[model samples]
Target: MRNGKGQERKASPSFFTGEKWLVLTGLLGFLLAAICGVWVILYGGPVFPKGDVLKAFSFNAALGVFLLSTAAILPFTALGNKSRALFRWSYIVLALYSYAAETVQNFRGVDPRFVKGGMPFDVWVGSIFTFVALLLILFYLFVAVQYFRPKAYRLRPELIVGIRYAMLAVLLSFAAGVWISFNNGRLVGLHGSIIWLHGLGFHALQVVPFIAWLSERTALTHSARKAFIHLAGTAYLVSLVAVGWQTYLGHPVLEWSVLPVLAFVSLLISLAPGIVLLRRQSDQTVPAGKAIL
Candidate 1:
């Protein structure tokens, strides 16, 4: 620990800080929600009508929620206080987007169902489900702020944790698929050729920013960046293949394949940016040591 004059300097962002816990919590929430969402899509059966689905999870609203959630948590975990405004606004955007989605769904002749029992397409029940998703995102946002403090910060541009999360997401998706098949006789919506590849493309897009952030933390060499970029591109291609297969099978949520692809793509993208900015302080690097604080 040395100051400018080479005197003793205490290391900043002490180990006891709560940033680590916040990140862990956020990551856990994200994973849990992702698993549940995938399960609902793959195994849970039709909870809402098609028009309602469009209304509740519109294209723009879905992107906003996904990115904002990522932005709210990932950056806070890494950069600490650097992007306070962005994080705060992400939350605001998340709420507004959810509200708008619900409203749109209602406006589209999608009446909320008042079911006495458990019908999957019950409108009221389905809308409530959206809140569950929103709640997960909101809780993660809170955890991000409370955990990742400003002081002793450094981004781990390598993004090992994120990659691990991605792997977990993949496992969860596969589990969801299997669970559905075992419980019911078949996979409901996301099983066959009825699926759409574009949804998978959107999933890939969702993860790019997160990976880009990871790249900001590491000190990547030019060659490494190029290699990583190629890897990311390849992962995207893999996602496309998976999506195509799902579509060919008429699967309902063919887009589920994108989550893992996003994870790999994110890692690759994050690693590549390090090459050009290796020498900088890497202000974005949140201390891996403190990830559980």
Candidate 2:
């Protein structure tokens, strides 16, 4: 495949062949759902319209179904022939079940909260979706491990690292979401900030991989690419922290404060790794008899 600039893009492994449409559909669902969420926030009044909220949940369920199905199928593309067939069917069945459960919950207007006096039928079904989603985290970890292994598929180093870190971020966000659900959708330490943390962490799956993809289209050296990934990821994490801190102090998400300054400083501190590596290279190039500058 070639990009718009006519650069030949790396072909996805055969394992993922014929799956591009599925990924695209999922992405579209996610985008539409995000737009709906923003619309609800802007136009649905302070309490929000129940209809819009329900529509958002419905669209979200569709997005989850498509996205999770894509995630579940990708691993099979790289698995050994013997294991591939078995795992493919297993993953398909699991993904379908998860998707069906989530869709049913949304259609039934089930509240996702774990209420007292035992959970309702639809809530129980919704919980199954959550459980299956969390279990899929192990599948992501497996994909990350496979990508990291020697003689594995020919993924770019930055892309592999991005996927690995994105997996971790997703895991953390999933755990946070589960915790919030159990606590009646209230955050413990950060109040409203847990939403920011969860949102930032999950979106790393898109952001980091995008950075890697764009870097690959450039004339960057491997070291430079790695440094860029580190810097971007660090800045991403710092921004998350800044927003979380601000929200924890009862500030709105868009409120400006010293947190941005702190986040900038933290991002600079994160560059210490790259800086140290550069200095080491400089020291190696210096003459034996030369005094250090």
Candidate 3:
């Protein structure tokens, strides 16, 4: 592709070829997870009593898809060849083990919770899964830092910034997940919460970049586009924090509360400057006789 200066820019080497297996497997896993999610929504009953077969299938499927997808995209960052190979193998092995462990625990009606007398097989396996998953979080954190480094792999600034924010969110979510696991899935007041925040945070990896990409296609100036990205990321983080605060207060995510309302209002307030800047940028781009709609 040619830049504005008419110079041709060579595309970065595609990670897809090297990671084809991961991509394919990840896509398959995601499809399976989607099917399972639908199945559980339609046929399954309550989500509790943890050993339900459909629930297990759905949960494991979702986890597998997430791990596989993470593995697939991780090499796109600035890892050296050796590091990339090691991460790839480790991720694949851990993902496979995690799926197997989940299946065994679910089928055998094992609870992930540890008992005073002895830990069940499921708890042991689940602990292993948690450990491996947390290790992967370190890799994500590394990638997040790499995004800001001088020699980092080239991408649009929006994508780099988005990924960095998303990884931060993922790290926070994983840390919270570890805490909840140790506390037997809930703190005294919080009950079995934190899931909402964790889910929202982790998915920011997709959501922020997608929004940034869409915004890049608009007629905004580079600075205005960046303003939009920063605004969106800040709003996203604030929303997560608000939900997390709610959960910490031992409230359901959707429960009417001052925190959430304030959070959204804060997001809108934070976005106003960006909106104004974007409007000015748009106006500047218009022709003398033409009006901006």
How big is the positional error of residue 165 in model 2, measured in Å on the Cα after superposition?
Answer: 3.1
After the best TM-score superposition of candidate 2, give how far the Cα of residue 174 lies from its true spot, in angstroms.
Answer: 2.4
For residues 1-293, write the lDDT of model 3, one tens digit per residue: 54334544444333343776555555655565565566567866333335444645655656655655465346546668887777667666766665566544544555443323334655577677677767767765665676666444243444456556667677777767776776666443744277777676776666665555545455555566666677777877887788778778887766557976765675565445445544454434532111112
TM-score, cand. 1: 0.32
124-161 in candidate 1: lDDT tens per residue? 54566355444544554454344334321233322333
Q: What's the lDDT for residue 214 in model 2?
A: 48
lDDT of each candidate versus the true structure:
0.41, 0.52, 0.59
lDDT for model 2 comes to 0.52
> What is candidate 3's CA lDDT for residue 170?
72
Provide the TM-score for each candidate, comma-separated.
0.32, 0.61, 0.75
Off by over 4 Å in 1: 1-61, 66-108, 111-196, 249-293
Higher-scoring candidate on TM-score, 1 or 3:
3
Best by lDDT: 3
